[model samples]
Target: MRPRYTVVASLSRLHRTFLTAPSSSDEGFDFIFYMTNKAKSINKALNDAVPLCNNPLVLKIHEAMRYTLLSGGKRVRPMLCLAACELVGGQESTAVPGACAVEMIHASSLIQDDLPCMDDDSLRRGKPTNHKVFGEDIAVLTADALIALAVKKLASSTSFGVSPERVLRAVLEMAKAVGTEGLVAGQAADLAGEGMSLEENEVGLKHLEFIHIHKTAALLEAAAVIGAIIGGGSDEEIERLRRYARCTGLMFQVVDDVLDVTKSSEELGKTAGKDLIAGKMTYPRVMGVEKSREYAEKLNREAREHLQGFDSNKVAPLLSLADYIVNRQN
Candidate 1:
């Protein structure tokens, strides 16, 4: 028989090969090139920001942090941030630090999201969850440390040529996104609604929207708005990007709900159908699969519409991202 290591290697190769193939949205977007180059840059930045530590005392915690932060996943939040900054006539360098900060916060959120008390998942990013690998104690610390580092990264944005006022605004904005106003609120609502009747009615739908907006959309909104701010975009530009990111964020979870049942575990890089099995409230559960898919498309259109009146060339990344969100098979 082939060695176990060889089988794992083959599976990894298959995963990458499958992901490299073009999705239906590839034709209009050139998403492969755009995602490749941008994800490359973001990955490098993330690596540089979170280097391995040699101090035996703290090395394990640091390793846990780096493991999750550097794990395989699309750098969507950072890319959205950089694209939003460029959309408003800002340089990519001006946004890279903030982009990294957003990803750190996002990575931190993922760690917390998969805890035994939360989603209770055993897999993430196609591998073991942080708590599963690092122990729950260290996993919690990893999330806390990442969030702290993210704030520290953002606080130093002025060094990257962002204005003091803008940097302050961005920090405060991200704090709101992470705290009670955003992820916390959404997670609370989600936990409360879990395994209970909160679907298929106007009230349930509204509750679901609240969960999506706060849990997912809040951080995304912060990512774009902070990017726009760092890019020196005007008030109008920031608000417009906020609306766009909100729609895109909602569409992301909507599509995730659809993919959960439609795709396999390998395809999604996580436990597929687990949400349905867990009695979790998802778009498909509340709206049905077809309606959920239709809602995702509707969100895509609205997200792109918000970018109208901007330079087409500049908005290409955001436009492509919206389409990619709706059309991505995984």
Candidate 2:
């Protein structure tokens, strides 16, 4: 793995040259180049941020936390948070706390969502689920601890240069995303919708969209908004970013739904086609795979439209991210 300082240096280089780079050539600013390096940056930052071995008194819980938190997967949410902050001209360091905070919240949600009472999955990112290894009780506590730690990190880990007001706002924003208004609301609605007849569960496009919006889009929305807040964006800029994030978030699920059918378990690094087995609502279940693909494409286009005002060079990461979210097979 690359060292942490190298990640910091890469981010610094982007900070200096990202906006000023010429837009004349397609190869001038490489999308893969940024995505690969930024993911490395996020992974290193996450490893450094989460307390894994500092205290023996809480070592058991820390082990469980590290099991899921450090497990391999694309660090999409945290990367989005950091990218959004940079897109709005914020220092990378200023956004690191918020980025890591969002990821912990995401991991916590996945742990809860995988409980026997919920999706009941046995594998995540090709490894056993948290509850599978830690037992259900420990899994619950581990998740709760992650959520609490996420909030604490956001409230206290921010650089002194960032105002207390912005930090407070970020904390409140993250809290809302994990509470009844966001992920919890989405999960509740999803659980309630299960076991309906095929026709009943297929339901309508509006209902399917609602589940994706709250369950998936809410956190993405919070990430973008919080990043903009820390970057000192104008209200107008933040709203536009919110819209962009909402579109990408839904597209992410739509693509995920499609890939569940198209890929194998080994390729996906999880139980493939689990959505169908659970009778859960998904884009393909209601709209068919082809239409789902079309819808993902449409959402991607719509997401890019919201970034029209930003410099093309600076927006390269965001634009590539929209494509990456949709095109990724796993």
Candidate 3:
């Protein structure tokens, strides 16, 4: 079956049954809407929770940290974390801390990526880059603080009902995903690839895959895996979720590349054509645009297939999210 057909057919059916249901009472619909709304509200609450250090010495630093953390961005990774937790039968309240930690890490990465030494763009999520507003030194410091705080919060937020072992594993997985073996190495390679001529070597593709997978996919994979772990999923289920996350993460990047080339900066909430200007390697740069889109659709279908044994109601959000991943304009 064609990938688009496979994914859309199932998703369309699910949407018709769940998302399209006509509610007899606005109150009942409102409650369901509230539950979805709460998932997004938690990120705002966590961002606001970043302590305003009373120490005059660190107060400015804290402010800069809050500036970027509170900036509007889709809390997709954290949402995935919560969704994964629910899919594995954990309460959303119990998953909040882990979700927050993931968002903090994601926000920190954006700060660093926006630095002069990195992607060097001056806008993010439709606002001035952290470095532009706070100065590079403060922005760098803020990113560092967020990273440290993410670890500390994950370690300290034990009241959320995740077991000690599971919390430890989640923290370790997050650390690995963001560390040198993960995002950092990918970034280094991405930066190094600028101005280099493409030779179509399989080795080069492997390197590109490593960079994209780590830089974009590792944390996403970790989000799902950590959620499953915290939710008491069996090892087999966790592995299956990991596979789904991996595919979706890559699909996310492919769609991102497509959008970067096709969409506007205002639409993207970030600079468009930066990839082209920077000469960064991307899916569209490697595979033709049509082929990349096809690949992403294929991956989305495979990801949904991986969830087939689970109750459709439970996995509905994830499946919808996968479709959103490819279809989103931003």
Residue 181 C-alpha lDDT in model 3: 70
Q: What is the C-alpha RMSD, rounded to one decimal, of candidate 1? A: 3.6
Cα lDDT of model 3 by residue, 270-316, tens digit:
78989989978888888778998999889988998888878765776
Model 3 CA lDDT for position 64 = 85
In model 1, the runs with Cα more than 4 Å from the true position are 1-29, 198-202
Highest lDDT model number: 1
Order of candidates by lDDT, top first?
1, 2, 3
- Estimate candidate 2's RMSD in Å: 5.7
Error of 3 at 202 (Å): 8.3
Model 3 regions lying over 4 Å from their true place: 1-39, 200-204
lDDT for 149 (candidate 3) = 84
Q: State the lDDT of candidate 2 residue by residue for 1-330, as single tens digits.
A: 433223343344333334444332234657656666767877777788666676876877888888888776566787788888888888877887788888889999999999999999998866789999989999999999999888877887455477888888888889899989899988998887776577785555777788789899999999898888887777888899999999999999899889998899866668998888887778888899999999998998999999998877788778877876766656
**Which runs in model 2 stand beyond 4 Å of their true positions?**
1-27, 54-56
List of clashing residue pairs for candidate 1: none
Q: For model 1, give the 10-residue run with minimal summed lDDT.
A: 2-11
* Top TM-score hit: 1
Looking at candidate 2, the ten consecutive residues that score lowest on lDDT are 1-10
Displacement of the residue 260 alpha carbon in candidate 2, Å = 1.0
